[model samples]
Target chain A: MIWKYICGSASSPLSVSFSERPRDGQVIFNSGVYLIGVKSGLLALSARCPHLGCQLAYNAADRRFQCPCHGSQFSLKGHRLKGPAKKEMTVLELRQDHECEGYKVIF
Target chain B: MQQTADYGQQTTDNNHGQRTTDNGPRTNYGQLALWAFHVALLTGVILSFHYRPWGDVFKSVSKISGWLPYGDFLRKLHYLAGQCFLILSFAHVLEHFLKETYRRIRPKEWSRLVLLFSLGFPLLFTGFILKGDKEGILAGEVMYHLAQEIPLIGSGLARMLLRPGEEFFLLPYLYHTVILPLTVIFLLDRHTRRLLPRGDWGWPFMAFLALLATFFPLPPDIPPYMEISHISGPWFFHGVQLLLRQVPPLWAGVIWPVIPLLLTALLPFAPPKLSKWGKRLTMAAWLIHGMILVAAWL
Candidate 1:
């Protein structure tokens, strides 16, 4: 089961469906990472790079997600704003609930 | 610059009978073409998640299952999107050529098209090779063997890369669909026009096409991965691949697709009847391409 937790206090961008997994193999993928900024903190994107299904890492210093193999980067808010990553990042809604403590990402 | 507004185009000559203000700067049709191209790209991206990439793995649908998130639907979407891409790119080119767009481009600009490596061939070549079935295997073999024909670079590289009997598989698929197309798109930008004002989904419709791809599809065989002594790529690309098998890669895959554009770009000076001849030549070229594809499938 997917663990559900609300993020900071403002949840927007409608990023819920990004968490679903597929049968796995070769299917269509607009796979991209979500670089999210919240009142709570920073987190890495779970979306795969469309280049070759390579996973991306979040570069907090740069405030972006970068693909290891292709070296594509995305900003903290998931806007591409970069190359080797033509498409924009996939967004996961950052749910902000009063009870939620830290920035929790579900992927 | 003295502007000569054509009095002949006056609204008085037509039903509206007044100067209409609807005229605005035209947008880049190339960008629209790019959007169409991206639709196929999105379809391909979604499909990649379900595809086996290696010919051996495609033996059963069960094998590839659980690999992707929402793989089945996306896979179908990808296939349909690719098919649409194939259709649209050709239609885009066909319409452009018919309109004599090349007439305006100089030799220098027209020549750059040679690097495109042929429209659908390489993409489809690597695409079918990733299917992981008997047909895919044969296609892989064809591609492997074809690559092996290179002199110093050919033999060693093919063996090292293709795994003898199999296609380079995933690597080619990843390269052809993603890396390569992105490259082509990048290159095409240098020779294209400004963006057209259209729907917000103009770009987002890449995904929409994939979603729509589900509606229209060609009947797919089980992956042709094992061994295709005689296999064909999607009908569009096969015309070139079949050429590479006999005419050498440089001739069919590289040089041929561009020569027409080069000639057409220069065609404005070739006398009016020559343009007539050129149009016929294009029709003939298209006809020959179709015949060659049909022959290969047979």
Candidate 2:
């Protein structure tokens, strides 16, 4: 469970609130795996836009994912907002590990 | 532009400075359509001897062009003749519009002609898809996806239109070879009989088509595994393809094409007072279509 290491414990003061400004807190483990700290909680999203398999870029100013190829937009929760993409971005399941210092992602 | 008492009977000046009894100006479009149809049929028959409908269709097409003697020539002739038929039919329709032949005498004929003309695009597309090459495969994929996206009955329609798996190749082959050709020929015969009563435009046009076929032969199909990024449909569909990139699949793939066709079919029934505006609108629609096609090419 990778989420355990990514998402800090509930007692940890390091859990930063999500902001609309550019931050260094976002972590991309691989091409499609992305981990970001949002106001709701730690959100993990598959960066691939469902429209045409183009990689999505996170826009800090808008706090949304935007596809460079077809301009498909998605919210922080992986819900599709606009553009030609028919489906939402895939949201990966994440869980907290009590023994670890961070969170664990359920594959 | 002089008229006689009998609508069927008229006199026209010939190329040799002699007055000939015929129906209006003999633009020979009907004759050209007849000849092109014949040439297409002949070449299709010849190509059918070698073209297999099922598995490895691309290979069979290649074999026809590569191994069989004069097979390549026949294939090219068939391809060219089909293209010629499309062009000739379009020209015939345009001539009717320009001459206003359909308005004064038979208004319904224009709608029928438009229907027939509309059928030509699908015929051409199905022919291209039958090749089963890289481009053909891509075209099939586009068609399948587009069909699948059509709201409720999409999946069922796609399954019916393009069977399951490799058998999909057979559907377009049937359409290109049998169904569409027969329908076009039937409509063409009726159209020619009504418009050009003097239908016997003899063997000279056939000879001309033969000469043209001999001079220009089509190239062979490319291999299926080629590295190509931009897969496009037939030229007539280029405009729609352009639209597909900009809009949603349903709108671009279905609605855009259907709109023009519906307008063309309904144009003849428009009130006489709106005839001028109707013609302008139709022309503008075609102009927009042409522009989209040009943009796609660019």
lDDT of 1 by residue, B21-106 (tens): 12311233334445665555765665555555544456434344445555556555555555555554455455555655445434
DockQ scores of all models, one per candidate: 0.01, 0.06
In order, the B-chain TM-scores come to 0.62, 0.84
DockQ winner among the candidates? 2
> Global lDDT for candidate 2?
0.66
Cα displacement (Å) at residue B52, model 2: 1.4
Clashes of each: 44, 7
Instruction: Tell me the chain A TM-score of model 2.
Output: 0.62
Per-residue lDDT for B117 in model 1? 27
10 residues in a row with least lDDT, candidate 2 chain B = B2-11
Top candidate by lDDT: 2
